[model samples]
Target: MAEEQPFALQRHEKLMERLRLHGAVRVRELADALGVSELTIRRDIAALADRGLLTRVHGGATLPTVLDETPARRRRASAPAFTIGMVVPSLDFYWPQVVNGARSAAAAHGVHIQLRGSSYDQAEDRRQILRLVESGQVQGLLLAPSLEGPGVAELIDWIGGLSVPAVFVEREPPRWTPTPRPLEWVRSDHALGLELAVRHLHAFGHRRIGLVLSKGSPTSAHLAAGWHRACEELDLPDDFVVRESVALNVPGHREIIGGIVDRCRRDRITALVVHSDPDAISVAQYLTEQGASIPDDMALVSYDDEVAHLAHPALTAVRPPKTTVGRTAVDMMMARLLEGRNRPVQRTLVLPELVIRASSITSSWQRETPPAG
Candidate 1:
């Protein structure tokens, strides 16, 4: 037997369908058609109004005129009139949120996002960006650059010469090198996020902290800076910080965690902080498999709070204000398009906050017990 739909959802669905077909609908008519009371229809209208899906009129409801097109149409028209190329290192879990934020922000201003993944490979990324620029189809670009790419300076020069605005996300260009033209950029304050995570761990009495990072990215650089800053503020020695870089893949992650565990055993590290939630979860799970007790033998903290909830022991993570970063990027792009090119270069750095959870706690074990000779 088929399950019946809930009354509220059914009412909302019917009302939306009616509005879509007829462009507007009266409460009484909607109630009669859906076999619900007029009062029920009014409630439904109010709910939709609260969601900004529709506007409530004197006796009826109307479609939201602000919506440029139906959801279906919007997905199909992902790349609208002006193509905005989005270049990222990979389409991992975190990238999706950043991309979603960009897409939503672009939609508000009637722009579109055409996405391309680089898989952290510099050569392929440069080729893709050059192709898009040479094609003359893309008006602007939102790039997340790899830190260790070859010929990066040459590529940046090429991009600058394209005569289109570019916004770097999650990474910043080198400060030492001057660009022929100024570039607008937007990024999450990873340093701030790491500081928050480290502070939380320190508050829980974790002194010997280890960081797991991915190498060759500006994001990693900022995180490293924050980790160093926290250690300085806490009056801890540089030796208290241990770091290992790994590629961002399944097998790579396994090897990295194995290395981290080995380091923990050798260094007597009590607390660990990872750069991403997925990595933290993986490390925790791997530690459990090895018969190590969490929050007792070791404490864990990480960044990107979404996947934290899904971990076996919900992870303590730093949540970046990604939505704000997205919206700000759009605002910057709009200003570039509408205003003259000679305006001052704009940069927006969104701050992140630490969300404490079960994964990290006060360290119970004071020292690693050694085997008797």
Candidate 2:
């Protein structure tokens, strides 16, 4: 049998499912259904409410009436002052949160978002962007393009020539060249997120921390920079840095992870900071299989918060402020479209938060140990 999930996470999953099936959930009913106390149910409702995931009524929670519309359906709403075309690398995982935030912000500001999903390939990015541009159905663009591809310079040049206003989401332009016009951007401070993860492990009495980056992600460079800087500032050992990212989906991932684990063991590294949650979870599984104790022998922190809470032992993770990045991109687009040349180039960097969990602490330690009796 599978191990039971943590109370908070279990409740959250059930609560979301209940809401989906019943359209709303009553606190007392949910408590009785889940075999938990009414107070616990109430707390869950309040937490979900605070996150804007649900609407809390006097005695129950209901879905947000108009705001809960699907992305495609939402786009069909009555034409507004502006229609913004958005293209992101992936619709799954991290990009969804950013899209939701953008949609919410657009709704609030009486704008419409025409979204398109693209793959990691630069050609796909260009194709999707060109489709949006050719459609001529949108007045502005919000893009999270693949910046590392060989065609990056050409892509930049094309975007520079677009007639409509454009704002990059979770991406920044190269600083080496002056473009025809100023570019606007809104991105999460991924570097700070990495720093936060390193600092968190350090606080747990880990001196030598290893870093495993995802070579495929643009965020890896920023994360590596932060990892090095934090080690220097905190006076911690930094020789265990892995310059290459371990791709979790590849066929030889297991062997690669085994090598990484062996390196950690040889270096006596007590903790690790991984680029994304999936990679971190893979490392955890490998460690468990190798007879190493999590948190006791090795503490772990994942960079992205997407599914870290679902990991065995529930990983501590750095959550990028995705929603804010999306919302801010829309806000910047609005300013640029409305103010025209009067508005200066807008650049915003939102901070990420560290979500602490059982994985970050030593398994042998208690949260509140009793004094000598």
Can you give the TM-score per candidate against the true fold?
0.69, 0.76
Residue-wise C-alpha lDDT for candidate 1, range 105-140, written one tens digit per residue: 778656778788886766777777877777776778
| lDDT of each residue in 11-119, candidate 2, tens digit only | 7767877686689889888888999898988877765554455787888888666665332233333347568999999989899999999999998667899999998
Question: Whole-model lDDT, candidate 1?
Answer: 0.73
Alpha-carbon runs more than 4 Å astray in model 1: 1-81, 215-218, 240-259, 363-373
Pairs clashing within candidate 1: none
Query: What does the lDDT read for residue 367 in candidate 2?
Result: 53
lDDT of 1 at 115: 84
Q: Which residue pairs in model 2 clash with each other?
A: none
